[model samples]
Target: MRPLLLLPLLITTASAADAVITYDEHIKPIFREHCLKCHGEDEQKADLNLANFTAVLKGGSGDKAVVAGRASTSLLFKAITAEDDAERMPPKKAAIPAPQIELIRQWIQGGLRESSASKSLVAARDTSFKAATALNFDGPPPMPESLPAFTPPQLKRPLPVIAMAASPRAPLIAVAGHEHVRLLDATTQQEIGALPFPEGQPNVIRFSRDGRVLMVAGGKPVQSGSVVLFEVKSGKRLTSVGDETDAVISADLSPDQKLIALGGSGKIVKVYGTDDGKLRHKLTKHTDWITALAFSPDGKSLASADRAGGIHLWDGTSGGILLTLAEHKAAVRALAWRSDSHMLASGGEDGLLIWWDTTDGWPAITNTNAHPPVRPAGYYGKLPNGVLALAFGPQGELLSAGRDKQVRLWAADGRALKSFASETALPLQTSITFDGKGLFAGDAAGAVRFWTTAN
Candidate 1:
C-alpha cells in the first residue's frame, strides 16, 4: 500500500535521472577538452574530425563515426570502449569514465540530433570569409575580397585571444582579439585606439620597430587570408598583403622595415617587400602548419617555426633556407631572438625553454623545462601543453607565458630569474608581450593583462 503511493514518485525521479545529453550541454565540453585539438582545428589527424556536426557524420580514415541509433556498431563508440589501450578512443589517455561512455552511448543510440552546438558548428563552417582557394604564388589577394562582405557575429564574439604585442619604442601595446585590434597605453592599459578588422580575427599584431605602423595578419578559416598595415597614430589603413586562403598565423616586420614575413596553414612562409607589397620569397620547407615567424633584430635573417617543432633560418634578402635549427619535441609556439640576433629563445609543447645559438649553426645552447610537466594532460610532462608566448625584455631577459597560466622571466643564458601567477586569469595565458617597462599577456577571458616588473 505504501509502495503504491511512492511508485509514481520513484518513476518521476528515474525519468529525470535520464535527462538528455545534448551536444551543447553534455557532450561538446568533454570533446572540447579532450579530442578537438587533434581532430578539430590546426590539423585533422587520420582525416577524422570531431570539430563539427557534419565532420562527425563524415567520419575519417576508418569511416562512419556514428551510424544513427547504432552506438554499439559505430567505430567512434568502439574506439572509446576498446579494452586494448592502443585501441582506446583517446589513443593515449587513461580511459574515459564509464558514465561518460554510457552517456555517449545513449546519445548515438538515440539519434544525433542537430542540437544548438551542432547548429553553431555548421554556421561557423559555412561563414568562411571567402571560399577556400588553392595556394597561389600570384601577388597576394586583394582586401575586401580577402575579407567577407558581412562579418559573422559569432566570430566577432571575442574568442580567446591568440596574439598580443607591445611596441618596443612606443608606450603602446596591441591586443588582437575576436575581430578587432585594440591599442592600449602600456602604462595605464587605457584604450588609446582601435582598428576594426572585418577581414577576420587578427592572428598576430606587431608594431613597426618605431611603433608608428602596426602590421596585422589574420583571415577566415579555409577562406581568404591577408595582412594589413595600419598607421597606428592615425588609424589609417596603410598597406595590405594578399593571396592567402587561410588565416595568417604568424608575422614579423623586419627591423629595417624593408621586408615582412608570415606563415600559417599553407605550410609555406612568404616573405614580402614592405615598400610595394611584392612577393619576395616563397620559403617552402615546412611540412606542417607554420606557427611562428620572425625577422632577426638586424633584419638580416628570418626564422620560421612550425607545429612539428621544425625551425628554419632563411637569408634575409634571398629567402633561402640557411639552416634548420635544433627543433622541439612538439609544436614551438613562441620564439624570441636576442637583441644582437646571436641567440634565439623558443618555448613550445614540451614546456621547455631552449636557447639556440643562431650564429653557430643554430645549435642548442640550453634546454630546460620552463615549468614542470603537468600530469594526466601532459605525459612525462610532454605536450598538449607548453609555453605559448615569449618576449625579450628591454634588458634582454626572456619573458614567457604558457598553459600553466604562469609568467616567468629568464636570464639571457636560460637561467630562471623569476616567476609569478596573476589572480585574474582563468588559466592558459597564451600570449605575452614586453613594452620595455611592463609585461602584457592575453588571457582566455578575452582580456589583455599588464604585469609590472614589481609584480
Candidate 2:
C-alpha cells in the first residue's frame, strides 16, 4: 500500500511540472514585455491590443491574429516562429525569446486557457464580445456569403513587385516591375504572356472598361512618358500615346470605354478619345503631381488626387472642375468609387482609408492605419508595402497576406476574422475581383487564390 501511494504521488508531481502555461503566467508577461509597447492597453498597433485576456482575444486591425485552439493558424505564433530575421516579430529591432516561444506553443497545443491572474483580469474588466460593424470600401457589392478557396500560383522571380492588376475578363494578371510586365494566368501559375519594354518601366497597368485593351504607363531612361494600349487576346499593341515630355503616373477609362484619363507630372489631366487615340481635353487644376485618378461608376465625374492630398473632381463631358476634396495629410495613393456613387474611398500615405460621402462632402467612415496606402491597391486592407497585401471578402471581411507567407481574414470593421497560409507558396500580389462568385487573389509568385464565404 505504501509503495503504490508513493508511485501515485510521483506521477502527480511530474504532471504538475509538465503542466501547460496559461494566459496569465506565460503569455501575458511575454506580450507585456515585448508586444505591448506598440500593441497595448492604451494603444492598439494595427488595431490590436494585447494588454489583457479580452484584448488579446479581441485582436486588432484585422481579426484572428491568433486562433485560440489552433497554434498553426495563429498569426502571433507564425510571426514569432518566423525563420527570417526580417520576418520576425517586434518588427525592426525587437525579438521574442526562444523559451517564451516554446511556452506559447505548448500552451496553444494544450488548449489555451486563462490562469488565475487572467481570470482576475477578466473579472476586473468587461469581457463581452462586440459584433464588428461593416466598413465602407468599394469592390463587388457585399454578399451574404464569401467565395470558395482558390490558391494563387507562385512565380520564379523574387524581385519585389510595386503594382498588380487583374485582367477584366480573363484569368490573366499583369504584374509591374522595374522594366517588365509579367502576364500570369490567374488560375494557373503558368506564364502565358510577357510584355517587355526596356524603354519604359511600367508603373501601372489597367484594363480598358471593356476588358479588350491593356494600357501600360511609365518611361525608361531618355524616354518620354507613354501609354500603350494592347489587345489582350493577341498581346498586340493597339495604340501608343505619348509626347516629347510628360510621364503618365496614373490612368483610367470612363464607363463607356470611349474616354481615357491620364494624370502625371505635368500638373494636367489629359483626356483622349479611345477610338482614334486623339487628345480631347486637358484639365489643369492640381498644383502637384497627380498620384491617383478614377472615374465614377456613372462616368459623369472624374476624380484626381495629388501629392498635396487634394482631390479634384471634374465634369467628364466638359473640362470643368466640380469640387476639390481635401483632408489627407499626405499624397493620396488609392481611390475607389463605391457602386452606390454616394461614397468615394481614398487611401493615402498617412495609412488611413477615408470614405467620403459625395453628397455631404464629408467622411462617412474612417479607418486609421488602413493600409500602406500605395498605388495599384492590392486586395482589401492589404497595402502594396513589402509586408502584406489586404483584400475584403464579399461579406466585408478583411483579408490580408502576411510577411510570414500567410493570408489572414478580418471583419470589415477591423476585427480579425480567420487566417490561412498557402500550403504551396507565397504570392507577390494578392487581389480580389468582384465576379459574383467570391473574392479572387493573385500573388507575385504567379498564383491565383480564392476564398469563398462560409455558410
Candidate 3:
C-alpha cells in the first residue's frame, strides 16, 4: 500500500513538472491571487481588465502587456519584475517570487498558450526564400500596362512623403502619399496611377526585384499595422501580412518574392510568407524600434537596423543571425545591399556612411562626413548632418539624401561624383532610375521631384 501511494505521488510530480504553462491552468491562479483586485472583472485600472486571456493580450493604455514570443520585452513582465517599488505590480508589495516569474516568462516565450490542448498562437513556420543564380529576365521588364484606376485621396494638405521606391527593372516610381501610393513614370515624371492604402499612411514602399509587385507597409500608430502587396501590372491586391499594434516602420520583400520581413516600434522583426501570410520567424533581438530593413538582392541575407544603432544580418531563409555589424553610434536610417550581395551600405544619424564587406562583416569603406552640414552665414547653433535615405544604381553607384538638404552621388569605389542641393526643404527619400540617368526624391514639404543626371 505504501509503495503504491509513493508511486502515484511520483507520477503526479512528474506530470506537473512536464506540463505546459498555460493561462487557465497556471497563470490565471496567480493573477487571481495577486492582480485581480485592481485589474479584474469588478475593477479595472489603466483601462486594463485582466480577467481573461484576451484582455491580458489586449493590454492596458500603453504598449501591449505581453509580446507573444518575447518575455524580456513584454510590459507585463517588466511590471512584475520592476526594481522600483512604486512602479512594480502589486504596488507596495514585494516582487513576485523568482520561480513564479520564471513561469510567466515561459508562458510568454512559449507563445502564450492558454491550455495544453491549444496550439501556439504565434508559432513561426519553417520557411526560407531560395535565391536564384542570377536576377535574369527573359523579356522586357514587367510594367503596369492596364492597372485598375482609383481616385486619389483628398488631403487636408499634401502629406509629407514618408517613403519611396524605384522599380529595379522598369521606368516606374512609387511614392507614398496621404492614404495612397502615387505611381509615376520615371521618364515623363507624370502620374501614372494611384493605389489606395486604406490601412493608413505608408511608411515604407518597396518594389520586388523583378519589378512584378510593389509592397506598402504602415498603419495607424499605436492602433493597428500591416503590409499590403499589389501586382504592378493589374494593380491587384496580392496579400497582406501582420496584425501589429503599431505602425510598421521598415519592411522589405525578398528577391524571390516568397518572403516578406517587416519591423515596427515593437522592436521585433517578423518574417511572413507572401502566399499564405503566415508568420515564419519572429526576431526579437533589437533593443529599440527597428528603423530600417533590406533583403540582399541575391536573396541570401536580410539586414535590419534599429533606432539604437544595432544592425544584424540574418539568413534570408532560416532567419538565423549571420552577423552583427556594429559601428554606427546613432540611429541607422537606411540599409541598401549591392546587387551582387557582396556588399551593404548603411547610413545613420551619426553622420556616417559605411560600406560593409559581407564576406567578413568589416567596414570596407567608412565616410565620416558623407553629408557634411553647410550652415548659413551667422547661424552657428548646429546644422543637420544625418543621412536620411539611400539608393543604389545598377552599376554599383550610390545615391543618398541627408538632413543637410543635399542629395549626392557616389561611385562604386566610394568616390563622390555629384551633389544636388534642395535649398530649403529637407530631402527625406531617394531612388535612382533603372537606366541610372535620372533621380527621384521626396522632400519634407510634401513634394516629389525628379532630376536628370548632370552632363
Candidate that scores best on TM-score: 3
RMSD of each: 20.4, 16.7, 20.6
Arrange candidates, best TM-score first.
Answer: 3, 1, 2
The C-alpha local distance difference test score for the whole of candidate 2 amounts to 0.60
Compute the lDDT of residue 263 as modeled in candidate 1: 91
- Alpha-carbon error at 269 in model 1, in Å? 0.8
Give per-residue CA lDDT, model 3, range 253-328, as digits (tens): 9988999999989899999999899999998889999999999987889999999989999999999999998778
- Cα-lDDT of candidate 3: 0.83
lDDT of 3 at 96: 81
Query: Which candidate achieves the best lDDT against the true structure?
Result: 3
What is the per-residue lDDT of model 2 for residues 1-455, given as tens digits with 9 covering 90 to 100? 00111011011111123575788888898888888888886788789888887777777777767764345457888888777989888888656877888677656544566784332111111212233333343454211122122233344564455456665445556777546666665555455556654546675677655556677877753447777776665666677765627557777777777787887877788888878888999888888888777787668888888887788888887868887776565677667665445556676655445556675455434443333222454556644332234433234444445334555444433344444454446543445444422344445554455554442
Q: How well does candidate 2 match the true structure in TM-score terms?
A: 0.54
- Backbone clash pairs for candidate 3 read none
lDDT against the true structure, each candidate? 0.68, 0.60, 0.83
Model 1, 277-321: lDDT tens digits are: 999889889989999998887777888999998888898888888
